[model samples]
Target chain A: MSELLLQKKHSSYYYVKSKLSTGLPLFAAIFLVLLIALLLLHFIWHGAPGITWAFLTEAPRNNNTEGGIFPAIYGTVFLVFIMSLLGVPIGTATAIYLSEYARQQSFFSRSVRFGVNTLAGVPSIVFGLFGVGFFVQFIGKGIDTAAQTTIWSKPSLIWAAATLSVLTLPVVIVAVEEALRNVPQDLREASLALGATKWQTIWRVVLPNSLTGILTGTILAIGRGAGEVAPVIFVGAVYSLPQLPDSLADQFMHMGYHIYVLATQSPNAADALPLQYASTLVLLILAFSLNLTAAYIRLRIRRSHK
Target chain B: MSSNSTLYKKSKFRPFEAIIEWIIRLTASFSIIIIFLIFIFIFKEAGGLIFGTAKELKPKKAVSEKVQDKSEEKVKPEIYNPETGEIVKIVEVKKLVKAKETESQSIWANLFSDTWQPVGKKPKYGIQPLLIGTFKVTLVSLLFATPLSILAAIYCAFFAKAWIRDIIKPTVEVLAGFPSVVLGFFCLVTVVQGVYSTTQFLQPLCTNIADIISWILPFSDRWIHSALTISDFHYSAVVGGIGLGLAVIPIIFTISEDALSAVPNSYREASLALGATESETAFKVMLPAALPGVVAAILLGIGRAFGETMIALMATGNAALFSWNIFHPVRTLAATIGSETGEVQWGSLHYNILFFLGILLFLVSFIINALTELFVKKYLSKKFQGA
Candidate 1:
């Protein structure tokens, strides 16, 4: 009877200890998830009421305290559009070279991979510094000197887009490479067996299958480029612009920059709170939806392959 | 068959395909070129300062112009009162100028000093305070994030059911999607207030604890008195650290979870067979097996927090004060560059210093990444292969 009692007590103690250990981690996980959910809900609750059609379409009238964010939205779209046009082709071609052409351990491919990793790790602010140094001072000034004009020697839409494309290059390349690799070896072998050249096989068989993936990569890159404020701060982003940019050289307002300005530099932060929340909500929706769509497509692709 | 042979003969000399291949190959080298350009351009701006050539311009011109203007004014004064005006006065001014020239210190002297007043009459560019602030914030964030993320990873990897794991994983992914600026804004508006209230509430209890401790350990009274005081709370390193912690948690969690999951299933089975419970098996067997990856995750997290700009900028109050107190407002290197690079004249000393900070950030991250890639990753591969 004594032995049985001791064993029962020991087992109960063990059970409680295990339960407590498990509970601790569970509590941590729940806490993290709840905090994020609360943050999102807070934004939506505060921002949803202020987001109207007028808010989306009209310009601010009283020094950015009473205007819609239409110009910011327009600038963001234009910036992303130019970034995609510049970055997507280069990234896709690089991915193709890495996946299809390079041998397993070539020095050239190894160096390229190293470059991509380092680029990805480089801070966004460093990218901003590099943009100012290379694009604005060196290349832009060089162009002005050649043309005998002052058009390209300052922060502008083209330089910002160019800087952003460089910043987003790693994202595009990684995504496209993953998608290209998902093309089956059998398909390429079959194409080659049919007397197709390597390029012809890749073009016909691999590229078609991975078209959705390439689109996904582009969307992901655009999403990332759109949300970035640091790289654009020195390159092109302005606090306010009276009108939308008329040319590549024109300065423009951006949504991320707009949020930053509203949050930090507003005359009356309390009064600007509603607009700030609304702008954040819009940007959040834009980024999350783009990421979600890309994720959904990636999931579908993986499932189809399986 | 004859047409097929003729086509094959034509395909053998296809210059178009050759050109296309060459184009693709050239495009592959774009990233390499861009990386090189980034390094070159950033260094080129700072090269004058690095090589002691920046001092050759602007300051000399300004000084000589001052002397010329002074001479012109003195000429009229001397003409009016030739006896009163002594030539020794001009010699004295020249001697003072020479003394000022000798007083101009090296970059290392300026960098090692604690003051960071870069826009004053006598601009001091001591980077020590910025370095300390960066270290303190990074430390706070690492302390806040590492354990919480590891525990969460433990839950997701070992304890949670598949459905729960799925939910938690996606939640973390969504959190990762929040941009750094948004996080900074959230910190500025929400977390700052939250910290203030919480510290206000805890102040009495903390003071009591400090009082008791100081009484017990009499020698620590002064230090405890200073450390325990939370009279007011505002934008501070602790707030910024928490904000950065928020950004870093998902990174650490994801990588840690991956590392934990990468442990071979055989180890779990063996641990179970040895009568170890689920938590014991995970804590003792899986965690140890995945130690290298977790360390790598942490190093990467530190790198991320160190270089993060917007959060440090908007939340830390952008004050470059050298203080050990977490409640004191601080500035980081990245934030310094982000906030100041815009207003500074191009190629000015401030501009060059900001680039120098950039180079420091770049080198640190490079070394961290190289360490992870070359050492930890190799060790992990070896360990898993041996398993």
Candidate 2:
């Protein structure tokens, strides 16, 4: 009993020493937290009622004080919607083909997986170069008149959306593949026993089981695609415009771009404060809503599956 | 008759299914097409700049013969001033040709060029100053970030109390959520300004120089003694690099900690059983075991440093001049692209020249990342039993 108590006391001593050693990470974390708090304080103090409903609805003009980010809101939403619409279908289909229809060790599938991972790590700026080269210069050439404008005519929203789809393609493939890999094999066997073909079994049993995961992954990809400034700047000439684009070809606005401009390129240089914060708040809200909706959809699918 | 019955009896349409499969296959193949096409696009735009204006004026020692010969005759030396023994006396002829080669070599030579004064109407797009500035800043950042990040991660994974670990991990991750632009703004308004104000107290710390040594000190007492301030050229790369380092440390620590945590439990237990101290196990056994992931994290940090634009763009003194001093501000390739891209007419010499810079950045970063993923992953980790 005495020996055990002595050992316990010894452990207590080491625990305190361990805590002392932990000081570095703890201090670094706390320092970061303190800086973050200071930044938020600065933001809130300078921007309260300025983050108004009016600010959200108004079009920016006269140094941005007289207008809001109506166009940007629409553009950001449309960008996310269109990118997700295109990216989800192709990525999910590819993931399905890779996971279900092919052997994992096959040369084709292995090479495909390798390409996808490498693509994911390629930098955003590099993607911008690619988009400008392929989408803007080459692909955009065929779609529009060469002398459409004095300069090269800007590629429309359709081109931007398509290019962004390519940029996020690897991410979607990785996500959906992970989701498919998690689905149980027993469900596939059960569906196959019911006289369904491999395609039908995969669609009905395996896909539905993983649909929630697929939705979540798609939402994450869209959220990421929307905020990206590099590729969009290269492929999409979205910035300040008085009117909202009626068609995909017309120049539009994006909340992320709006924040970037207000902080960097605001035409109305003096009043960038309220505009930057308000746009940031809107972006976060949009991202959160998209994620939450996907979560909600996932839950609904789970409940129905059960 | 049998095939017709197959089509009519079932709505499944096997041929249609085959067509859809073909479509999907095309889409899969399309990914490759996109990558290949992108490379083609970058090289096409960048080609005119790198090849040079004329064959005779092309780089004396060609990296390749064909590339040298194909250069436009515009840059070839047609006139000379043997009077002063200058190879090319007429600046205008060379100006036009050098403008095209300025796409790549101009800035590279600028890295070694002694003076930063823009010649006459157009400044030759020399990059030596910016390259010097970038390296100095990056070196400082590594100095600030590497030791702190590695040590903090080691401390957290090996020594932290469980309760503290949970709190520390999440908080550090939340730093990733902060937009990089915001970090730049913060550094500009606060860190840069703070350093400027403190310049008064630091002025006395300058090293004393005798008459001959004065020439070697790079800057005189007047510049060092002046109040720290911000303008286009006069600024601080030290602050910018440190600020960037702070922004990147979380990335390093997060990955490094994961590497540390993933170290096999048996190694720690064995070390402990052998009467090794906690610090010894962490530094010798666990760290060695975790070296692969640590290497990955370090390489990731380096790649990030090379590519980061917004903070460096806004904070680096924006002087496209080369200086060895750590305190003086400098420009990075990323900053140059950001500042010049908007102004340069798209598809013109200046514009193509900027793209050439992008090509350099892409090539350098791509090589680093590829090496890390390909070579370091196998060799470094295996040496430590971490791969």
Candidate 3:
């Protein structure tokens, strides 16, 4: 009878232990779910109703208390366009150099890698300062002195785009390098054996295959550049710029900066609440869609390779 | 199989390969050049403030005869005129700084103090308050966020079913991609309201605790009152901390989850086979193995919190004061630079000061990142070696 009681006690203890372990992890999973649910619910409940056609196509009226954010949208699109134009090619080239040309353990390659890593870790505010000091002051002043004009001696879209490109370069390089390295070594060897030169093989075989991945990187960069406000605030973003930028030298409005200005600097935060939420929604959708597309492309590539 | 054949093949594409390779090398070197330029330009502006230009040397002749000859003083007076002027007056004017500094507090001296008055007759560029403010907010954020992120990471890495894991991972990562400006706005509007009321809701409990403590100590009531205010809570360090905590959770979660998942499955199997519970295996076996990665993740999260700009700027009320109170508003280094750099004069002392703040941020983040990278590299190599 004592032995039977001991067996029953041990079974109960094991049952309780198993139940406790499962319950703990379940609680953690629930907590994560609740957080994500709260974020989505908050944004959609507050923001989705404000996203109307009038909100999208029209410019702000009455000190941004009314109308849509057309100029802010246009400015963000233009900035991303210019940023990609500058960031993608150079980023792709650098990745190719790292993966294909430079020896893995070479000093130059290590330094380049270190530079990319350091640049990646530098704060966005520092990038803003660098933009103002280097692009707006030194290089812009040099250009002004050379041309005997004041055209490029201040914050402008070009300077902001350039700063953002530098900020996102590491992202692009990592993505592109992964893509380049994913191309099978046997394919490159086969191309070389078929009398194709190294550059010819790279240009014809490797780059063509990795173009989708490179595009994915550019898309990711655009998504990041679109959302970043700190790097462009002092460099080029304007609070009440009513029109689309006519040239790269013109200061532009941005969705992120506009939200910040409206939320913090507005006279009537209550009245501007709808606009702020709507602008945030637009920015969220933009960044989300871009990220999703890149993720999808990466997934497709991975699947195809398998 | 002949060396000559290989040599001939190499020679065929030597010129093309050389030019293409040079272009690639140039593109790669451009990143290094840009990084160096960032260092150079920031320091150049910051250095200008530390060392100003030379003093003006005016040749002022000391009238030996005490004659009031202002006009003759302008000209070099002759040695034998009625009185000889032999002395020089060197008027050493102070360098043009951004703010008018009083004679008592030097810039270096002011930085060690708690006051951060940057625009006035006696402008004080005290970094102590900002540092304290940063530390307070970061501490609050990490305290609130680290456990949540770590537990969630463990759940995702070990316990979540496959479909649930797929949904949870991307959804959380979506939070990571959300713009900080939006997060700042949300904090300004929603989170601040939530935090204020939550603090207010805890008033009775706080008073109870304070009452309990007051029985032991005479000054507990005053300390509690100062620590927990009944009302008047608006934009504050607590609000900023919550906002920053939200911003950092995704980073910490993603990194820590990766670290947890990178632990070898054999460890889990062995622990399970030895009759250990799953939680025991996870908490005892896996967590210890992934401790380096976890440390690296937390350090990266702290680095991110230190450099975060928009949330702190919008939510922290931009008040620079000397208080250890978490309920009061405080400014940060990143926010100060973000808000002030736009209006500051290009070559003024204030502009250079902002650049100096940038340098401080750069250096701090650099050190944190270097340490994090060191630990992360070790973790990755250890994982790869199957040990």
Candidate 4:
């Protein structure tokens, strides 16, 4: 480096330009920090005082102006739980198909990839509409007509979770596919050479190795499902439900939807301000923690692989 | 153990394995099926509006007409029920299927107007305002996000020290995980207010260009104000756009950063060895080399912004208005779907229009995604094949 510097003897103009260039990264990093700080500050300023154990656990009173958001929290968890339960299997299977089974350049694989990509690009609101059209009005109403009852004809938790599962399908598929692709081909060949069938090799080796990735995908989907509001809006979520949903057919409260209702539909948006912020804070915490956990797990897995 | 070994030998051609494989393959195809179903259902529902129903045949009216038409040659067609082998009741299914009266006006004329009143005496389904709103928010967000993210990406890829790169990359990527709803909430409750106050503070200093224009033309100042403000210190496109910018930044940064980092080390070495400073090397050499990929990143960012729903719905004041000004509230197609889908009557013109909007959003995003993929692929090919 010193020899090169001696050979080059750069001009002062070039030196000043390089010095100024360093500022760009510094400026960018500082901007990011500031944005994060501002978000944190807003949450702390409005949400801190209102965030009590009771607020976290108790049901709201006074048209949701007062009391805790226990139901909303529970509903969000349950919704994400259902979404992951249904989404992960298909997503993982698709990942396996793409990674291990389908020839990459084949039309089937390409179309599957295209489907995943297009699904990812579809707006969440469209998913909501799809839920209303396919799940509620069509399927739900069909169930009602068949059973001669209206029990299955309305928006419910199952429909919302199903909608969200589809919405998060790409996230899981991409994550698990990346994981499955990372599994060494040498191990698979070795396993096959040892007389294990393709299925056995995948089951005993590839899936076990990609466990972290599957979990990462599940965690990311949970975070995404928990925070999404549009797909749940008409399909199931309500501002206030009589009780926590005991069955998939029941409507439920959600933190994101609660915040929306408080912000937009509350008779007194001002009175609900603190509670709204608190719900937003809770939603942010839940989502960020899920994402951070996924990231941390991925980091650990990468480190271990190294 | 000997018996189990024999059993395993007997099961060499495993039916269980075949079944499992079939199940897995079926599961893998679920997404394709759902995508097809989504397209089918949305279009079918929208078909009610596209091809309006043949007039209402109320049960009472139908029965009376059937009684009257029974003697006529052009009577209502009927057939025996397959199960009962008898003529069954003909259920009339024709209410709520009025052909849109826009027959008096051309489709282009109706769609290009300023009003978006969908449920009044004369329903005007002018999509012009929605398009303007969507583009306004999208353009504003892109204008803010693309440069910042690209610059940041460039810095991270080429300029940042090791520790800084390690810290910055993950943190910024984590920002992508923050749901648009949360961002929308923050903007609605906090950021928009902040922007409003800042705008107020700068109001005196920031003279409106409209002021000059209004002086030249004899238009009312309120017209400019209406263009500028839904009201002072309220939700506006600027706030929604900035919120969208926040949502868009992570996407652009992540992709552009990858592209920048993917540039061969040889280029950097050559540039640096040529007596160019690191910044000049980055700005002149690395950036231009990664330009296609960066452009792809920007396109994907635009797709994200265009299709984003919750943030715009929560922050854009949900007003369907036609205005060029950034200060006023603007309604986006995704937001309209989010806010209005519930209230709209099923199979109504309003309902179908929302789905039509969804189709429009879907097509735009589909094109953008395809283009981005093409650009990124070209960039990758160029990188590897040295085109």
TM-score per candidate, chains pooled: 0.92, 0.76, 0.89, 0.86
For model 3, the stretches where C-alpha displacement exceeds 4 angstroms are: A1-25, B1-13, B52-105, B219-221, B228-231, B383-386
DockQ of 1: 0.48
The lDDT of each candidate is 0.87, 0.65, 0.83, 0.81
| lDDT string, candidate 3, B1-387, tens digits | 111112114555477678878988999998899888988888887865555310110111122212234433653443334544433321111122211223222556765777888788656778888888888888888987788888888888888789989988988888889888988888898888888888778888877777778778876668766675554658888889888888889888899899899888998999999877778888888988888889988988898889999988999888987788888888989999999888877776677778888888988988988898788886566665845
Model 2 segments beyond 4 Å from truth? A1-22, A33-49, A101-110, A145-152, A193-195, A266-270, A285-306, B1-32, B53-120, B160-164, B198-201, B206-235, B375-387
Candidate 1 lDDT tens digits, A177-233: 888888767787788779888678778998999998899999999989999898898
What tens digits encode model 2's per-residue C-alpha lDDT throughout B67-121?
3344334345644565776656345544645555553455446434654433345
What are the runs in model 1 whose C-alpha is more than 4 Å off? Answer: A1-17, B1-15, B55-92, B217-219
At residue A251, what lDDT does model 2 achieve? 61
Best by TM-score: 1
lDDT of 3 by residue, A1-306 (tens): 879856864897867976766676677667766976788788888999999999999999888899999999999999999999999999999998888877666799878887888788888889999998899999999999999999798999999999999999998998998888777676788888898887888899989999989988999999999999998999999997756899999999999999999999899989989888889999999999999999999988887776
Model 1 docking tier (incorrect/acceptable/medium/high): acceptable
lDDT of 4 by residue, A1-306 (tens): 888776555777656666767786668767975776777677878888889999999999998889999999999999999999989998999988888777656787778888898788787888898998899989999999999988788999999998999999999999898777677666777877788877888899889999999999999999989988988999989878888899989998888888888888899888888898888888888988899899898888777766
Can you list the residue pairs that collide in candidate 3?
none
Model 1: lDDT equals 0.87
At residue B186, candidate 1 shows an lDDT of: 95
For residue B31, what is the lDDT in candidate 3? 85
Off by over 4 Å in 4: A1-22, B1-19, B54-109, B206-233
Please, what are the lDDT tens digits per residue for candidate 1 over residues B36-99? 9989988887776676557643386568658857876865455444666556556656676665
